[model samples]
Target: MLYRPNPPISFTGAVLDRADHIRADADKLAELMNWRARLLRLDGLDPVIGDDGALVWGTLADAGEHDELVFLGLDESGRACFAPVSPANKGNPGPANPRLWGAMASLPAGDLATYGGARALVDWHARHRFCARCGYTTKLGKGGWQRKCVNMDCKAEHFPRVDPVTIMSVEWEGNLLLGRQPRFPAKRYSALAGFVEPGESIEEAVAREVHEEAGVRVRDVRYVACQPWPFPSSLMIGCHAYADDPAITIDKTELEDARWFTRDEVVYAMEALKTGAEDGAFIAPPPFAVAHHLLKWWIEQ
Candidate 1:
């Protein structure tokens, strides 16, 4: 079976017999390996490896002997956490040696795609040194999985933060609504998404995002899958919603344009763009993206 990178496996959990013992005492393992340890900076994902060293990819359980490895932090619920490494890390120095700094928002996403978990987590820790409650300095603990507020009275325990977002493909008849953000590369467009607000459920967030971005009410919202969008920590909750209307009233401030396209058009765009399709045509985010996954699910349906 072709490995379908989906669900919990795509972001966390892997099938490995040995790695099940690794998590409880990761600090010891990492510390022991530190001397010969290839210190990897997965921040911003542009990795730089040393001369012909070993690198493990994916979760430790899914890892091979020669693959590069990284350590992501624990989830808020204290379960379901793992790192990511890919075939791309071969012969490349870890992220720290690469000196990558551009748009802050793009770093996490860009790094997760290119680098490993260490880079992304380290970057997250760097930005979250101050406590959200008392604005006091915090210190790393639990193998960098958490930070404790220095203030003894207000010692707030903070874990790596992940914003929950909902991105959906709204279908009406045989057409799907798609949109392009202002910051997206020219002619690039994908599914609509927005952050879940306080006191909101996932379905409500999906409906709200669709209405906010494209001015269309959505119904029959169904959970599809999720992607750990570690661009400084986001969990993208993917869904498929039925569009109640097709006419788009674009919120130009957020989206440059919004429109509906037939499945055939989407297929042609994806295929043509693969072999250098038309310049003015649309391009989807790579298949790894939840947007792409959602789009793929739409097309296949």
Candidate 2:
């Protein structure tokens, strides 16, 4: 079931949603002020983790004064939820303070989705505090979902956005094409990806990215599963394509190296990445990324 449709893909199926009942009722908004509601305290953009490698969910009593309070959807148990951004100096700490990727891998599917949504929403609020039309500050509305400008003359509203990116695995002549960027870790390589341009389709973006990076033309672009990559906020559209030509012509600007690997080599690299073996000449992206799932699908094929 490696490529199964419902395999716990990271940041995908969020159970706690904004149903019509919850949105229309005024009582639901009062849940944020309740003492029993769970709170996820973030230090700037980083989440606070406990000693057991899980995100620390605290009550109102445990959190310090926060700047913004975002209503993250309820948990699986149907409890009210909120994520408050603590001041930079007041973050909770434990034995280790891991970043988003590491914390995501250790969390359950529901928690991961909740955290991703909260992070994206919180980041949007942090970046968009003022209206573009007027120089007036905006106020949170719709239970922290919308921001409206305070100026009576220009009441501009803003909503959160998720950038779409196309990530694909290109295959030709029984070999898969992978590339490494200059900033990537030493000896690590993964699927090719690029942002979708204005008025461009996902399939076109996949083919264009493969050609632009590796000088390879791809066709038969097929849709695969997708992941919500919430680094800042992006929806990665996973795909699989077939390369028409196998010749390697690396784009020095986009990638440090681009080469084709046989199925066996890819299989070995995947195993090494899973076991954290450093001896291998090639290392795959970590399992938390959609690139890893793309590689895993190719290996299963």
Off by over 4 Å in 2: 5-7, 13-15, 24-27, 61-66, 85-98, 279-281
Error of 2 at 294 (Å): 0.9
Which tens-of-lDDT digit does each residue in 224-293 have in candidate 1? 8787755656788889999866878999989999988888888877776567777535786555567877
Q: What does candidate 2's lDDT look like per residue over 1-301, in tens digits?
A: 3376435678877867654355435587775457777888666667677787666788766666655566776666666777764434332222123355577778777667777787777777777778988989987766667788999999998887788999999999888899998988799998988989998999989988998888899999988778987767789998999987798788898899988888888888899976877876589887777888888887777
Provide the lowest-lDDT 10-residue window in model 1.
Answer: 96-105
State model 2's lDDT: 0.77
Residue ranges of candidate 1 with Cα displaced over 4 Å = 1-38, 42-45, 49-116, 279-281
Among the numbered candidates, top TM-score falls to: 2
